[model samples]
Target: MAAPTPVRRGAARHSELFDALVELLLTEGFAHLTLDDVAARLRCSKRTLYTLAGSKEQLVRAAVVRFFARATERVEAAVAACATPADRVAAYLRAVAAELAPASARFVDDMAAFPPAAEVYARNTAAAARRVGELIGEGVAAGDFRDVPVSFAAEMVTATMVAIQQRRIAGATGLADAEAYEALATLLLHGLARDPATPARPSAGCRS
Candidate 1:
């Protein structure tokens, strides 16, 4: 076997650094930490950290982007394994909750305070809303859900997600972010369920 090339080695090191950076930010946040602090915590030199990004703000933003990119991949994988539209919807939201389970409140607050990181989070939230809309549409087409306005339902879900991210739901309901996501999934599934009295139509391609 050929030895690993320098480029491959550098890429592996960068991936390791990114994973460490994301773990640090998710648990402890970035607003209170300087670049020096990050280097110290990661047990690396400032020069090495610069290889990832030019500044602390940019580094945090990159980490945020990496975190969401990984989370989306896992969430989609979970959704794809489900056999029915309802199962897909539930798996998507629950997978999101599992992915976010590691994010501390401090990290969430820091993201809200940092404009660049916050923007990344906002974009991901919007994407998640669009995904939910697609799942809901599938459920409706399959007769598993009511034929409600897809856009309206998606918008409502988006509002709830924003509230959860901003901690409004936490403040009002005392639910953690992960718990809130689980609740949202349950509520959405229940809300979209077909009425018991309604006759069941043979769903095309839906598995029991």
Candidate 2:
């Protein structure tokens, strides 16, 4: 496989300002956060803020990057802990289902409500897709997933989850329980379950 590309960094790369902006954005929404407010939160000057990350948009993008970076760490750690490939994939999705934060949901809504924000979100989401695809490839290597196109299957799972997240952001989180078992069950029915032994566990249905 070819090497994945990397993203470039911009001015105003101070980690402190980056974090403050993310927190403010999370609590106040990007629409309400201002550079001045961010400076105040960080006990810094407007000069310091501008010297580092530039406009609110840049700061916001940095925040998104930081958020996903941290999330990658957590999800990777979760995926690594499972005993088998099937279990790892299950653990990975479950971790994603469980990782939704109100701030993340709010960010999704705010971005969809505004065009430029939507573009930033699109870039971030594309990066996220590659990460998810890598996880699926790992599962395939372990013989826990069907021998199919990893990127496409990964995309299917990623797109479905994005739809779920968007619905959650829109206050239309359709399920009664956030456990996401219904989707999990659906995946199993569609033969996403890689471990043949998995269905045999009391949850068995349609096992021949």
Candidate 3:
């Protein structure tokens, strides 16, 4: 077989670099890091970093977008593997929590402070809420959920998600963001369960 083309190799390298950058930001936060710092952390030259983004702010924004894009893909995969609507919903939230497990408190705080990154997070949150609504509607139609208003239930979940992202839930309940997501999944699934005594079926990759 022929070796990969130059363009393909470059694209692959860019992807690897971006993954490293996102991991770094998620672990350490971006607010205190300069371009030099980032370059040093990634073990790449500043020129290579510029190839990904023209400026530090842009790089951070791009990383945030990439993070959520990857996360959404994984979350959807989890939901798709589920056979029941209730399990899909539970899987969605559980996947979200798993995706967010790597993010540190500092990273969350920095993302909130950076408007571009924050906007990306906000958009993802809204999209998640809509996805939850759709899942709830499906459950209701399947007679798996109670006759609750889908819109209201979705909005409540959205509000809780926002609070989780903002650290309000942590402040109020002492639950970390990921922990809050787990609790949300449990609460939502139990509340929506047609038989309160029966537990929602766990989906692939989803914990109890």
Report the lDDT tens digits of candidate 2 across residue range 14-116. Answer: 6656766667666666766677777787788889877666787776766766765676677667767766655555656655555434355456566667666
Candidate 2 has what TM-score? 0.64
Number of the candidate with higher TM-score, 2 or 3: 3
Using all chains and alpha carbons, the TM-scores for the candidates as numbered come to 0.93, 0.64, 0.93
Q: What is the overall TM-score of model 1 with all chains considered together?
A: 0.93
lDDT of each: 0.90, 0.60, 0.91
The prediction achieving the highest lDDT against the true structure is: 3
Q: What ranges in model 3 sit over 4 Å off? A: 196-208
lDDT of each residue in 1-208, candidate 3, tens digit only: 9999999999999999999999999999999999999999999999999999999999999999999999999999898888888789988999999999999989998999999999999899889888998999998887778889988998999999988877789889988788999999999988887765756445344343
lDDT of 1 by residue, 19-78 (tens): 999999999988999999999999999999999999998999999999999999999988
Considering lDDT, where higher is better, how would the candidates rank from best to worst? 3, 1, 2
